[model samples]
Target: MQRRKYLKGMATAAGIVTVSSTGNAQVWDSDELSKGEEPKNPSPPRKGDSVMGLTDQIDTVNVGIIGLGNRGFSMTQLIDAMAPDKGVIKAICDIREKPVEEMSDWIKEEGKNDPPATYSGSKNSWRKLVQRDDLDLVFVFTPHQAHTPMAEYAMKKGKHVAVEVPAATTIQECWTLVDTAEKTQKQCVMLENVCYFDIEMWVLNMVRQGVFGDKLTYASGGYIHNLVAEYFFEAYWKDWRSKNHRKYKGDLYPTHGLGPIAFYMGINRGDRLEYIASQESPETQLTERAKELPEDHWAHGADDWANGDTTRSEILTEQDRQIHLQFDVKTNRGYSRKNELAGVDAYHEGFPSQLAVDSEGHGFVDDATYDQYYEEYRHPLWVQMEEIAEEYGGHGGGDFLEIYRLFDAFNDGRPPDMDVYDAAAWSAVRPLSATSIEYGGIPVKFPDFTRGDWQNKRKLQVMDFDTI
Candidate 1:
């Protein structure tokens, strides 16, 4: 594959060029991928990068999982269904006893292996589980607050870490994971399943192949799912998604929207986030809903619903690319990811499915043409693994695919596709957006979790991860 260059001038200064127009959308592109000039490749493996990619080759990975909430149970079920041959659940930890027992029993019921030691009954019980030496990989599916600390501790204990998204809730924690992963050489990957989503990865394959002209300029997405019912349901917990409405603001969960776009744009690989500015919609929707609740209801109380009903953040990269992110959890509207990608002569947009200009700047493609595109551009990894992935299940089999690749990478003596730098970078969006939101949409710079190494060394190597 050819080394790609940064679209610094193109992304920053290129004006929109109108090629031709369809019904509602315009035929416009800024820079085509193949038209860009090549830049020199950065040195391979910068300092402190020895531990950044793949771990030392290992045999079967032994697993210890923490948290048995919604995501936790799903992961447990995934392992139960798919990972028996590749790894063992050596230990399990969850604050909730019921799910833990259920998982332990499920593992045993399947007769895959011996039932693992289980931990519950206390908040600190996970620490004990982490201390065990038998665990080769510690999976953290706990609440948002525990992600960083648990991952840090597990890496220190000589275990690779696979935690749920936003690997850290704070910038300092992002730094902690970065520094820790460098010292430990134990992999820390945020299980961002969206990166493996069917449609997303299809677009990623096209982007990587430079199908859409390489001088990439803009990308946008959203986490706009209506959660009114989930928020007001009687069983809602403070630690989960429900109560977060009344707490912090600014895209609380950003990795889903950011992950795929960043990959397509080579963020943290060649480009870096320069600064961020965010603005939030009013918190009126949640408050209006609270009006109908009884006085004793949690929503009727004085909790601080600091988060806006919707937030849109504009982020600029050092390479001059632009990213527009949206967050709208409080609305009554259905879920949508307003995913859009644009370059010199090709672009895409969404309300439902996207209408994209073909790679050769031919014309706009509508939803009716999606099947042919899917047939042509589906990621090769998905082509090979989607069958088994669908059987194991998760966000359109993304969960199974990611887990499969993790194990495959380990057995193959290579790093899994996602590393600690990617984890921390994607995870930091929430807290960073929070800081930017609080100060009236001021420009806040994101930390370089890879230090300065991202400038030269970190290129996306998808072919290395091209197996199940």
Candidate 2:
């Protein structure tokens, strides 16, 4: 099937219009909107081709996962669910004993005969896991600080590494991972979950098909739901939150909001991140609330730290594209995580939440007004996501697709959807954004992690659905 045919019936209010085909750029009307459900088409070649092709070329690429925390466990579950035809999980490691034991038991209980060998001990146990010659790829899911060291170790050991978000905590570490990957000729991918979201993938498909005209500018959005009190009170990583709360406070988690935008904008591949400036709200209600807790409470000491407020980071690309990224743990007592994207050329399409591309020639507005308009113009990805959620079922089904792609890449010897440079560019934003906060909201230049050859990088591989 042609790429453009997949975008049929994608329209939304607020002038968020998407091109219908490669040759014909038509604004889809409300009548084109999918109502009940959309049919599942064949898999795209770029999506599954590389991995499928590589499976026969290479033998099994043994996988190892480090840091079996919440995210780590989720990743392991997804890997287990992959059709055995792809790859197998060979090892698992974590400092926390409980998760390691639990994951091992779960693997055994499920009768997955190829269950990964479990490793757990002191914080330094990660080195042992990376040194294993039996492993082909290692997934680093530890905290922000450990991303660099673990990645470096894995790369040097001739193992491909897939680190969790914020690939590195500092600029130096960022370069270390990139340089090591280049030196070792091994892949190091930052597992930015948002990049694999079905909605994001669909939008990428639209962009590849030129459904959105020469993309002008796009915006990335994020909102912190500080509903989890544990983040502030729990003694996580030597109580790091309470200890350094004041030192590094802005945009603590920027990858989820920035990853999709970077991929869609071709950051590193076509466009480069020029600079970033972040502004944080002076008052932190959440921090103040933590202070009021009794001294006996686990996080009572956290109150003595920094205030809990909102911070917004605006990054500009070399191509002059602007990405408005907002991060906040303070909310008016509610649950919310908002991610939105805006483009000058194409209409809007979003799922798992409301999104619309204005087709009436009207401009964009705030979420409230956008929602009012979205009721009129809606994209088919909304309904499609529900079915996707059911089948894949990780991080709204995006997780499963990501793992599937990873295993396929190993099998086919093709680069992943989000490659080494893509990982560095997106994950590096966290520390780079933090620098702005350190400098009192000043604009900071984002390092070209690719050492300035980002523009000449290979074009992203697209999954050819017809061949599948």
Tens-place lDDT per residue, model 2, 1-468, is 321232232223211122111111222243543332322212112211111111213456677889887778878877776535676777889998899989988877766546678788887777887888888888888777788899988988988888887887665676677677777777887787777775566666656655556664766666565643555546552634444455566677778877777767777776888656777777556466667777886656454445337778887677767888877665664443345555655555343454445556565445886555444322233333456545758877777767766766677766666666676667656666665665555445555555556767455653334211
Give lDDT: candidate 1, residue 89: 81
Error of 1 at 123 (Å): 1.1
Worst 10 residues of 1 by lDDT: 18-27
Model 2 segments more than 4 A misplaced: 1-57, 233-246, 304-308, 333-338, 347-389, 462-468
Model 1, 392-464: lDDT tens digits are 8888798988887787777777768888888877877787787667655655556666667577656465544
lDDT per prediction? Answer: 0.75, 0.63
Report the C-alpha displacement of residue 103, candidate 1, in angstroms: 0.9
* Candidate 2 lDDT trough over 10 residues, lowest sum: 43-52
